[model samples]
Target: MARALQACLDGEVDEVTAQRVAVHGEGCRRCGVEITVYREIKNSLARQEVPDEAAMARLRAFGADLLTTGPAEAGDEAARLGGT
Candidate 1:
Protein backbone atom coordinates (compact mmCIF):
# COMPACT_ATOMS: atom_id res chain seq x y z
CA MET A 1 0.00 0.00 0.00
CA ALA A 2 2.88 2.31 0.72
CA ARG A 3 4.30 1.51 -2.67
CA ALA A 4 0.91 2.16 -4.23
CA LEU A 5 0.73 5.52 -2.43
CA GLN A 6 4.20 6.35 -3.69
CA ALA A 7 3.02 5.46 -7.17
CA CYS A 8 0.20 7.94 -6.67
CA LEU A 9 2.61 10.70 -5.60
CA ASP A 10 4.77 9.93 -8.62
CA GLY A 11 1.79 10.00 -10.97
CA GLU A 12 2.43 6.38 -11.92
CA VAL A 13 -0.92 5.19 -10.60
CA ASP A 14 -4.29 6.30 -11.91
CA GLU A 15 -7.14 7.77 -9.89
CA VAL A 16 -8.71 4.35 -9.52
CA THR A 17 -5.60 3.15 -7.73
CA ALA A 18 -5.61 6.11 -5.41
CA GLN A 19 -9.26 5.59 -4.61
CA ARG A 20 -8.54 1.99 -3.69
CA VAL A 21 -5.77 3.13 -1.44
CA ALA A 22 -8.09 5.65 0.14
CA VAL A 23 -10.63 2.98 0.88
CA HIS A 24 -8.10 0.65 2.41
CA GLY A 25 -6.59 3.45 4.39
CA GLU A 26 -9.97 4.22 5.83
CA GLY A 27 -10.30 0.73 7.29
CA CYS A 28 -6.69 -0.04 8.21
CA ARG A 29 -5.00 2.06 10.85
CA ARG A 30 -1.48 1.40 9.58
CA CYS A 31 -2.30 2.33 6.02
CA GLY A 32 -4.18 5.35 7.27
CA VAL A 33 -1.10 6.54 9.16
CA GLU A 34 1.07 6.02 6.12
CA ILE A 35 -1.27 7.94 3.89
CA THR A 36 -1.32 10.78 6.38
CA VAL A 37 2.45 10.81 6.40
CA TYR A 38 2.54 10.79 2.61
CA ARG A 39 0.19 13.73 2.44
CA GLU A 40 2.20 15.67 5.02
CA ILE A 41 5.45 15.03 3.19
CA LYS A 42 3.90 16.05 -0.11
CA ASN A 43 2.47 19.19 1.43
CA SER A 44 5.87 20.08 2.87
CA LEU A 45 7.49 19.70 -0.51
CA ALA A 46 4.84 21.86 -2.11
CA ARG A 47 5.53 24.60 0.46
CA GLN A 48 9.05 25.17 -0.85
CA GLU A 49 9.57 28.57 -2.43
CA VAL A 50 10.50 29.22 -6.05
CA PRO A 51 13.58 31.29 -6.88
CA ASP A 52 11.79 34.14 -8.64
CA GLU A 53 8.53 36.01 -9.11
CA ALA A 54 8.24 34.83 -12.71
CA ALA A 55 8.36 31.21 -11.61
CA MET A 56 5.64 31.87 -9.08
CA ALA A 57 3.49 33.48 -11.73
CA ARG A 58 3.99 30.46 -13.95
CA LEU A 59 2.86 28.20 -11.13
CA ARG A 60 -0.18 30.35 -10.64
CA ALA A 61 -0.98 30.06 -14.33
CA PHE A 62 -0.56 26.32 -14.22
CA GLY A 63 -2.93 26.10 -11.27
CA ALA A 64 -5.42 28.20 -13.17
CA ASP A 65 -5.22 25.80 -16.05
CA LEU A 66 -6.08 22.94 -13.70
CA LEU A 67 -9.01 24.90 -12.35
CA THR A 68 -10.34 25.46 -15.86
CA THR A 69 -9.62 22.05 -17.38
CA GLY A 70 -10.37 20.02 -14.24
CA PRO A 71 -8.42 17.15 -12.70
CA ALA A 72 -6.63 14.33 -14.50
CA GLU A 73 -9.39 11.74 -14.05
CA ALA A 74 -12.03 12.11 -16.74
CA GLY A 75 -15.73 11.55 -15.91
CA ASP A 76 -14.94 11.01 -12.23
CA GLU A 77 -17.29 13.41 -10.51
CA ALA A 78 -15.78 13.24 -7.01
CA ALA A 79 -12.37 14.01 -8.48
CA ARG A 80 -13.79 17.32 -9.69
CA LEU A 81 -14.37 18.57 -6.16
CA GLY A 82 -11.87 20.74 -4.21
CA GLY A 83 -9.45 20.87 -7.19
CA THR A 84 -7.74 17.66 -6.16
Candidate 2:
Protein backbone atom coordinates (compact mmCIF):
# COMPACT_ATOMS: atom_id res chain seq x y z
CA MET A 1 0.00 0.00 0.00
CA ALA A 2 2.78 2.43 0.90
CA ARG A 3 4.75 1.63 -2.26
CA ALA A 4 1.74 2.09 -4.56
CA LEU A 5 0.33 5.16 -2.81
CA GLN A 6 2.30 7.76 -4.75
CA ALA A 7 1.79 6.11 -8.16
CA CYS A 8 -1.88 5.70 -7.41
CA LEU A 9 -2.20 9.38 -6.51
CA ASP A 10 -0.27 10.34 -9.68
CA GLY A 11 -2.52 8.15 -11.82
CA GLU A 12 0.60 6.32 -13.02
CA VAL A 13 -0.42 2.97 -11.54
CA ASP A 14 -2.25 0.30 -13.57
CA GLU A 15 -5.93 -0.41 -13.01
CA VAL A 16 -5.14 -3.37 -10.76
CA THR A 17 -2.86 -1.25 -8.60
CA ALA A 18 -5.38 1.56 -8.50
CA GLN A 19 -8.03 -0.92 -7.38
CA ARG A 20 -5.77 -2.33 -4.71
CA VAL A 21 -4.97 1.11 -3.33
CA ALA A 22 -8.58 2.18 -3.41
CA VAL A 23 -9.66 -0.96 -1.61
CA HIS A 24 -6.90 -0.64 0.95
CA GLY A 25 -7.64 3.05 1.45
CA GLU A 26 -11.27 2.18 2.08
CA GLY A 27 -10.32 -0.15 4.90
CA CYS A 28 -7.41 1.89 6.29
CA ARG A 29 -8.21 5.23 7.91
CA ARG A 30 -4.60 6.35 7.76
CA CYS A 31 -4.33 5.65 4.02
CA GLY A 32 -7.53 7.59 3.35
CA VAL A 33 -6.24 10.58 5.35
CA GLU A 34 -2.87 10.39 3.60
CA ILE A 35 -4.52 10.35 0.17
CA THR A 36 -6.69 13.31 1.07
CA VAL A 37 -3.74 15.32 2.44
CA TYR A 38 -1.58 14.57 -0.60
CA ARG A 39 -4.38 15.49 -3.00
CA GLU A 40 -4.86 18.78 -1.14
CA ILE A 41 -1.13 19.53 -1.27
CA LYS A 42 -0.93 18.75 -5.00
CA ASN A 43 -3.93 20.94 -5.69
CA SER A 44 -2.54 23.79 -3.60
CA LEU A 45 0.80 23.68 -5.43
CA ALA A 46 -0.92 23.60 -8.82
CA ARG A 47 -2.75 26.80 -7.95
CA GLN A 48 0.50 28.69 -7.22
CA GLU A 49 2.06 30.98 -9.81
CA VAL A 50 4.73 29.66 -12.16
CA PRO A 51 8.23 31.14 -11.92
CA ASP A 52 9.72 33.52 -14.53
CA GLU A 53 11.43 31.36 -17.18
CA ALA A 54 14.11 33.93 -18.01
CA ALA A 55 15.02 34.34 -14.35
CA MET A 56 15.06 30.59 -13.92
CA ALA A 57 17.35 30.22 -16.94
CA ARG A 58 19.76 32.80 -15.53
CA LEU A 59 19.84 31.01 -12.15
CA ARG A 60 20.56 27.70 -13.89
CA ALA A 61 23.38 29.33 -15.86
CA PHE A 62 24.84 30.76 -12.65
CA GLY A 63 24.78 27.28 -11.05
CA ALA A 64 26.45 25.76 -14.13
CA ASP A 65 29.19 28.41 -14.00
CA LEU A 66 29.81 27.63 -10.32
CA LEU A 67 30.15 23.91 -11.14
CA THR A 68 32.62 24.57 -14.00
CA THR A 69 34.93 26.79 -11.92
CA GLY A 70 38.52 25.43 -11.70
CA PRO A 71 40.11 24.34 -8.41
CA ALA A 72 42.53 27.31 -8.56
CA GLU A 73 39.66 29.73 -9.03
CA ALA A 74 37.81 28.09 -6.11
CA GLY A 75 40.91 28.59 -3.95
CA ASP A 76 41.05 32.23 -5.09
CA GLU A 77 37.40 32.60 -4.13
CA ALA A 78 38.09 31.05 -0.74
CA ALA A 79 41.00 33.47 -0.19
CA ARG A 80 38.74 36.39 -1.17
CA LEU A 81 36.34 35.19 1.56
CA GLY A 82 39.33 35.53 4.03
CA GLY A 83 39.95 31.73 4.18
CA THR A 84 43.48 30.34 3.85
Candidate 3:
Protein backbone atom coordinates (compact mmCIF):
# COMPACT_ATOMS: atom_id res chain seq x y z
CA MET A 1 0.00 0.00 0.00
CA ALA A 2 2.82 2.36 0.92
CA ARG A 3 4.64 1.28 -2.23
CA ALA A 4 1.51 2.02 -4.27
CA LEU A 5 1.28 5.51 -2.74
CA GLN A 6 4.97 6.16 -3.39
CA ALA A 7 4.71 4.88 -6.95
CA CYS A 8 1.73 7.16 -7.56
CA LEU A 9 3.57 10.15 -6.15
CA ASP A 10 6.69 9.35 -8.19
CA GLY A 11 4.58 9.07 -11.37
CA GLU A 12 5.80 5.51 -11.86
CA VAL A 13 2.25 4.11 -11.84
CA ASP A 14 -0.06 3.98 -14.84
CA GLU A 15 -3.23 6.06 -15.18
CA VAL A 16 -5.34 3.09 -14.07
CA THR A 17 -3.12 2.53 -11.03
CA ALA A 18 -3.28 6.23 -10.20
CA GLN A 19 -7.04 6.20 -10.45
CA ARG A 20 -7.23 3.09 -8.27
CA VAL A 21 -4.96 4.71 -5.66
CA ALA A 22 -7.07 7.86 -5.68
CA VAL A 23 -10.23 5.83 -5.17
CA HIS A 24 -8.56 3.73 -2.46
CA GLY A 25 -7.31 6.87 -0.71
CA GLU A 26 -10.88 8.17 -0.54
CA GLY A 27 -11.97 5.12 1.45
CA CYS A 28 -8.82 4.53 3.53
CA ARG A 29 -7.94 7.05 6.26
CA ARG A 30 -4.27 5.99 6.41
CA CYS A 31 -3.86 6.24 2.65
CA GLY A 32 -5.58 9.64 2.72
CA VAL A 33 -3.03 10.93 5.22
CA GLU A 34 -0.16 9.54 3.15
CA ILE A 35 -1.55 11.15 -0.01
CA THR A 36 -1.95 14.52 1.71
CA VAL A 37 1.58 14.40 3.11
CA TYR A 38 3.02 13.47 -0.27
CA ARG A 39 1.08 16.27 -1.96
CA GLU A 40 2.39 18.84 0.53
CA ILE A 41 5.95 17.60 0.11
CA LYS A 42 5.64 17.75 -3.69
CA ASN A 43 4.25 21.29 -3.51
CA SER A 44 7.04 22.43 -1.19
CA LEU A 45 9.70 20.96 -3.48
CA ALA A 46 8.14 22.60 -6.55
CA ARG A 47 8.38 25.98 -4.79
CA GLN A 48 12.14 25.71 -4.15
CA GLU A 49 14.50 28.11 -5.96
CA VAL A 50 17.81 27.08 -7.47
CA PRO A 51 21.11 28.86 -6.76
CA ASP A 52 22.04 31.48 -9.35
CA GLU A 53 25.07 31.34 -11.64
CA ALA A 54 27.23 33.61 -9.47
CA ALA A 55 26.52 31.53 -6.38
CA MET A 56 27.32 28.35 -8.33
CA ALA A 57 30.60 29.87 -9.58
CA ARG A 58 31.68 30.73 -6.02
CA LEU A 59 30.80 27.24 -4.85
CA ARG A 60 32.77 25.69 -7.71
CA ALA A 61 35.78 27.87 -6.85
CA PHE A 62 35.58 26.83 -3.21
CA GLY A 63 35.41 23.16 -4.26
CA ALA A 64 38.40 23.65 -6.55
CA ASP A 65 40.44 25.18 -3.68
CA LEU A 66 39.62 22.17 -1.50
CA LEU A 67 40.60 19.77 -4.28
CA THR A 68 43.87 21.60 -5.08
CA THR A 69 45.03 21.71 -1.43
CA GLY A 70 47.72 19.12 -0.66
CA PRO A 71 46.80 16.14 1.55
CA ALA A 72 49.54 17.17 4.03
CA GLU A 73 48.17 20.70 4.18
CA ALA A 74 44.67 19.34 4.74
CA GLY A 75 45.95 17.12 7.55
CA ASP A 76 47.74 20.09 9.12
CA GLU A 77 44.58 22.22 8.91
CA ALA A 78 42.46 19.40 10.32
CA ALA A 79 44.93 18.94 13.19
CA ARG A 80 44.78 22.68 13.93
CA LEU A 81 41.00 22.38 14.12
CA GLY A 82 41.35 19.54 16.70
CA GLY A 83 40.47 16.86 14.10
CA THR A 84 42.51 13.65 13.85
Candidate 4:
Protein backbone atom coordinates (compact mmCIF):
# COMPACT_ATOMS: atom_id res chain seq x y z
CA MET A 1 0.00 0.00 0.00
CA ALA A 2 2.83 2.38 0.83
CA ARG A 3 4.54 1.43 -2.42
CA ALA A 4 1.32 2.06 -4.29
CA LEU A 5 0.92 5.44 -2.61
CA GLN A 6 4.49 6.45 -3.42
CA ALA A 7 4.19 5.22 -7.02
CA CYS A 8 0.96 7.16 -7.45
CA LEU A 9 2.46 10.29 -5.98
CA ASP A 10 5.58 9.95 -8.14
CA GLY A 11 3.48 9.29 -11.27
CA GLU A 12 5.40 6.05 -11.77
CA VAL A 13 2.33 3.80 -11.82
CA ASP A 14 0.28 3.15 -14.94
CA GLU A 15 -3.35 4.19 -15.29
CA VAL A 16 -4.75 0.86 -14.05
CA THR A 17 -2.56 0.89 -10.96
CA ALA A 18 -3.36 4.55 -10.34
CA GLN A 19 -7.10 3.87 -10.62
CA ARG A 20 -6.79 0.97 -8.21
CA VAL A 21 -4.90 3.14 -5.73
CA ALA A 22 -7.52 5.87 -6.05
CA VAL A 23 -10.35 3.41 -5.48
CA HIS A 24 -8.58 1.90 -2.48
CA GLY A 25 -7.91 5.31 -1.04
CA GLU A 26 -11.57 6.20 -1.39
CA GLY A 27 -12.65 3.19 0.68
CA CYS A 28 -9.87 3.32 3.32
CA ARG A 29 -9.59 6.29 5.67
CA ARG A 30 -5.90 5.67 6.37
CA CYS A 31 -5.09 5.39 2.70
CA GLY A 32 -7.05 8.56 2.04
CA VAL A 33 -5.01 10.44 4.66
CA GLU A 34 -1.79 9.04 3.24
CA ILE A 35 -2.76 10.14 -0.26
CA THR A 36 -3.67 13.62 0.97
CA VAL A 37 -0.38 14.03 2.82
CA TYR A 38 1.68 12.76 -0.13
CA ARG A 39 -0.18 15.02 -2.53
CA GLU A 40 0.36 18.07 -0.32
CA ILE A 41 4.07 17.30 0.00
CA LYS A 42 4.41 16.72 -3.74
CA ASN A 43 2.62 19.96 -4.55
CA SER A 44 4.67 21.89 -2.03
CA LEU A 45 7.92 20.58 -3.53
CA ALA A 46 6.68 21.36 -7.05
CA ARG A 47 6.11 24.99 -6.02
CA GLN A 48 9.69 25.49 -4.84
CA GLU A 49 11.95 27.80 -6.84
CA VAL A 50 15.27 26.60 -8.24
CA PRO A 51 18.45 28.27 -7.06
CA ASP A 52 20.04 30.81 -9.39
CA GLU A 53 23.32 30.33 -11.24
CA ALA A 54 25.24 32.40 -8.73
CA ALA A 55 24.03 30.22 -5.88
CA MET A 56 24.98 27.08 -7.79
CA ALA A 57 28.42 28.49 -8.50
CA ARG A 58 28.90 29.28 -4.83
CA LEU A 59 27.90 25.72 -3.87
CA ARG A 60 30.37 24.28 -6.41
CA ALA A 61 33.15 26.46 -5.01
CA PHE A 62 32.29 25.39 -1.46
CA GLY A 63 32.36 21.72 -2.51
CA ALA A 64 35.76 22.16 -4.17
CA ASP A 65 37.07 23.89 -1.09
CA LEU A 66 35.88 21.06 1.13
CA LEU A 67 37.54 18.49 -1.11
CA THR A 68 40.91 20.30 -0.99
CA THR A 69 40.84 21.11 2.72
CA GLY A 70 41.99 18.73 5.50
CA PRO A 71 39.40 17.07 7.73
CA ALA A 72 39.71 19.67 10.53
CA GLU A 73 39.51 22.58 8.10
CA ALA A 74 36.57 20.90 6.35
CA GLY A 75 34.74 20.70 9.66
CA ASP A 76 35.34 24.39 10.27
CA GLU A 77 34.22 25.25 6.74
CA ALA A 78 31.08 23.16 7.16
CA ALA A 79 30.34 24.97 10.42
CA ARG A 80 30.83 28.31 8.70
CA LEU A 81 28.47 27.16 5.96
CA GLY A 82 25.87 26.16 8.64
CA GLY A 83 26.22 22.47 7.86
CA THR A 84 26.52 19.76 10.50
Candidate 5:
Protein backbone atom coordinates (compact mmCIF):
# COMPACT_ATOMS: atom_id res chain seq x y z
CA MET A 1 0.00 0.00 0.00
CA ALA A 2 2.79 2.39 0.88
CA ARG A 3 4.60 1.38 -2.30
CA ALA A 4 1.55 2.23 -4.37
CA LEU A 5 1.23 5.61 -2.73
CA GLN A 6 4.90 6.42 -3.29
CA ALA A 7 4.65 5.29 -6.87
CA CYS A 8 1.64 7.50 -7.35
CA LEU A 9 3.51 10.45 -5.95
CA ASP A 10 6.54 9.78 -8.13
CA GLY A 11 4.38 9.36 -11.26
CA GLU A 12 5.70 5.83 -11.56
CA VAL A 13 2.49 3.97 -10.88
CA ASP A 14 0.31 3.41 -13.92
CA GLU A 15 -3.32 4.40 -14.13
CA VAL A 16 -4.26 0.78 -13.55
CA THR A 17 -2.25 0.68 -10.33
CA ALA A 18 -3.88 3.87 -9.16
CA GLN A 19 -7.30 2.56 -10.03
CA ARG A 20 -6.66 -0.60 -8.09
CA VAL A 21 -5.58 1.43 -5.13
CA ALA A 22 -8.70 3.54 -5.45
CA VAL A 23 -10.83 0.43 -5.42
CA HIS A 24 -9.04 -0.87 -2.34
CA GLY A 25 -9.46 2.51 -0.70
CA GLU A 26 -13.19 2.33 -1.32
CA GLY A 27 -13.49 -0.84 0.76
CA CYS A 28 -10.82 -0.40 3.39
CA ARG A 29 -11.10 2.27 6.01
CA ARG A 30 -7.35 2.47 6.59
CA CYS A 31 -6.60 2.77 2.91
CA GLY A 32 -9.33 5.36 2.59
CA VAL A 33 -7.66 7.37 5.33
CA GLU A 34 -4.35 7.05 3.51
CA ILE A 35 -5.90 8.25 0.26
CA THR A 36 -7.58 11.13 2.03
CA VAL A 37 -4.28 12.02 3.65
CA TYR A 38 -2.56 11.84 0.31
CA ARG A 39 -5.12 14.18 -1.26
CA GLU A 40 -4.93 16.63 1.61
CA ILE A 41 -1.13 16.60 1.50
CA LYS A 42 -1.22 17.28 -2.22
CA ASN A 43 -3.68 20.13 -1.78
CA SER A 44 -1.76 21.66 1.09
CA LEU A 45 1.45 21.64 -0.88
CA ALA A 46 -0.31 23.15 -3.87
CA ARG A 47 -1.67 25.94 -1.65
CA GLN A 48 1.69 26.86 -0.17
CA GLU A 49 3.23 30.20 -1.25
CA VAL A 50 6.89 29.48 -0.65
CA PRO A 51 8.72 31.98 -2.85
CA ASP A 52 12.20 31.81 -1.35
CA GLU A 53 15.20 29.60 -0.73
CA ALA A 54 14.37 29.11 2.92
CA ALA A 55 10.99 27.73 2.04
CA MET A 56 12.46 25.59 -0.70
CA ALA A 57 15.08 24.30 1.71
CA ARG A 58 12.41 23.43 4.19
CA LEU A 59 10.57 21.53 1.51
CA ARG A 60 13.75 19.75 0.48
CA ALA A 61 14.52 18.80 4.05
CA PHE A 62 11.04 17.45 4.46
CA GLY A 63 11.47 15.45 1.28
CA ALA A 64 14.70 13.99 2.60
CA ASP A 65 12.98 12.99 5.82
CA LEU A 66 10.11 11.50 3.91
CA LEU A 67 12.54 9.49 1.81
CA THR A 68 14.25 8.02 4.85
CA THR A 69 10.99 7.13 6.56
CA GLY A 70 8.85 6.08 3.56
CA PRO A 71 5.28 6.98 2.70
CA ALA A 72 3.29 5.57 5.62
CA GLU A 73 5.50 7.15 8.24
CA ALA A 74 5.61 10.42 6.34
CA GLY A 75 1.83 10.37 6.05
CA ASP A 76 1.56 9.65 9.74
CA GLU A 77 3.83 12.57 10.50
CA ALA A 78 1.77 14.80 8.27
CA ALA A 79 -1.36 13.71 10.10
CA ARG A 80 0.31 14.52 13.41
CA LEU A 81 1.15 17.98 12.06
CA GLY A 82 -2.47 18.57 11.02
CA GLY A 83 -1.63 18.00 7.37
CA THR A 84 -4.44 15.66 6.56
Candidate 6:
Protein backbone atom coordinates (compact mmCIF):
# COMPACT_ATOMS: atom_id res chain seq x y z
CA MET A 1 0.00 0.00 0.00
CA ALA A 2 1.09 3.53 -0.65
CA ARG A 3 2.01 5.58 2.41
CA ALA A 4 0.01 8.71 3.12
CA LEU A 5 1.24 11.29 0.62
CA GLN A 6 0.06 14.18 2.79
CA ALA A 7 1.95 12.73 5.71
CA CYS A 8 5.08 12.71 3.59
CA LEU A 9 4.49 16.31 2.48
CA ASP A 10 3.89 17.43 6.07
CA GLY A 11 7.13 15.68 7.15
CA GLU A 12 5.22 13.28 9.37
CA VAL A 13 6.86 10.30 7.71
CA ASP A 14 10.24 8.86 8.69
CA GLU A 15 13.22 9.12 6.35
CA VAL A 16 12.78 5.65 4.85
CA THR A 17 9.10 6.26 4.12
CA ALA A 18 9.92 9.66 2.65
CA GLN A 19 12.55 8.08 0.39
CA ARG A 20 10.00 5.51 -0.82
CA VAL A 21 7.48 8.20 -1.67
CA ALA A 22 10.14 10.24 -3.45
CA VAL A 23 10.96 7.21 -5.61
CA HIS A 24 7.30 6.56 -6.38
CA GLY A 25 6.76 10.20 -7.25
CA GLU A 26 9.64 10.05 -9.70
CA GLY A 27 8.03 7.25 -11.73
CA CYS A 28 4.46 8.64 -11.53
CA ARG A 29 3.85 11.95 -13.31
CA ARG A 30 0.58 12.82 -11.49
CA CYS A 31 2.04 12.04 -8.05
CA GLY A 32 5.14 14.06 -8.93
CA VAL A 33 3.00 17.09 -9.90
CA GLU A 34 0.93 16.88 -6.73
CA ILE A 35 4.04 16.74 -4.55
CA THR A 36 5.72 19.60 -6.41
CA VAL A 37 2.57 21.79 -6.30
CA TYR A 38 2.05 21.30 -2.56
CA ARG A 39 5.75 21.94 -1.86
CA GLU A 40 5.59 25.21 -3.78
CA ILE A 41 2.41 26.27 -2.02
CA LYS A 42 3.93 25.57 1.39
CA ASN A 43 7.13 27.40 0.46
CA SER A 44 5.21 30.42 -0.85
CA LEU A 45 3.10 30.58 2.29
CA ALA A 46 6.23 30.38 4.44
CA ARG A 47 7.63 33.50 2.73
CA GLN A 48 4.54 35.65 3.31
CA GLU A 49 4.51 37.97 6.36
CA VAL A 50 1.29 39.07 8.03
CA PRO A 51 1.55 42.72 9.03
CA ASP A 52 -1.04 43.17 11.77
CA GLU A 53 -2.36 40.52 14.09
CA ALA A 54 -4.29 43.04 16.17
CA ALA A 55 -6.08 44.54 13.17
CA MET A 56 -7.02 41.06 11.96
CA ALA A 57 -8.43 40.25 15.39
CA ARG A 58 -10.41 43.49 15.40
CA LEU A 59 -11.83 42.71 11.96
CA ARG A 60 -12.81 39.22 13.06
CA ALA A 61 -14.52 40.66 16.14
CA PHE A 62 -16.33 43.20 13.96
CA GLY A 63 -17.53 40.41 11.66
CA ALA A 64 -18.84 38.47 14.63
CA ASP A 65 -20.61 41.56 15.93
CA LEU A 66 -22.19 42.09 12.52
CA LEU A 67 -23.50 38.51 12.55
CA THR A 68 -25.01 38.76 16.04
CA THR A 69 -26.09 42.42 16.11
CA GLY A 70 -26.95 42.96 12.42
CA PRO A 71 -26.63 46.24 10.54
CA ALA A 72 -28.62 48.33 12.98
CA GLU A 73 -25.79 48.74 15.47
CA ALA A 74 -23.01 47.94 13.01
CA GLY A 75 -22.20 51.56 12.47
CA ASP A 76 -21.64 52.16 16.18
CA GLU A 77 -19.66 48.96 16.56
CA ALA A 78 -17.63 49.73 13.47
CA ALA A 79 -16.94 53.21 14.80
CA ARG A 80 -15.90 51.81 18.16
CA LEU A 81 -13.89 49.01 16.60
CA GLY A 82 -12.19 51.53 14.30
CA GLY A 83 -13.60 49.71 11.25
CA THR A 84 -14.34 51.74 8.17
Return the clash pairs for model 4, or none.
none
C-alpha lDDT score of every prediction, in listed order: 0.77, 0.84, 0.88, 0.87, 0.81, 0.83
After superposing candidate 6, which stretches have Cα over 4 Å from the reference? 1-3, 50-84
lDDT of 1 at 68: 76
For candidate 6, write residues 1-84 as lDDT tens digits: 234778898899999999988898899988898888888998877765555677889999988988998976867888999877
In candidate 2, which residue pairs get closer than 3 Å at backbone N, Cα or C atoms, i.e. clash? none
Best by lDDT: 3
TM-score of 6: 0.54
Displacement of residue 63 (Cα, Å) in model 2 is 40
lDDT of 3 by residue, 1-84 (tens): 899899998899999999999999999999999999999998777765553667779989988888888676889999999996
- CA-RMSD of model 1: 16.2
Report the lDDT tens digits of candidate 4 across residue range 1-84.
798799887989999999999999999999999999999888877765553668779999999887877698968889999997
Q: In model 4, where is the ten-residue run with the lowest total lDDT?
A: 44-53
lDDT of 4: 0.87
Q: For candidate 2, give the lDDT.
A: 0.84
Clashing pairs counted in every model: 0, 0, 0, 0, 0, 0
- TM-score for each model: 0.52, 0.52, 0.56, 0.56, 0.52, 0.54
Residue-wise C-alpha lDDT for candidate 5, range 44-83, written one tens digit per residue: 7877745567888999998898798888896888999998
Give the alpha carbon lDDT tens digit for every residue of 20-77 in model 2.
8988888999998888888899887776556467778999998888888857789999
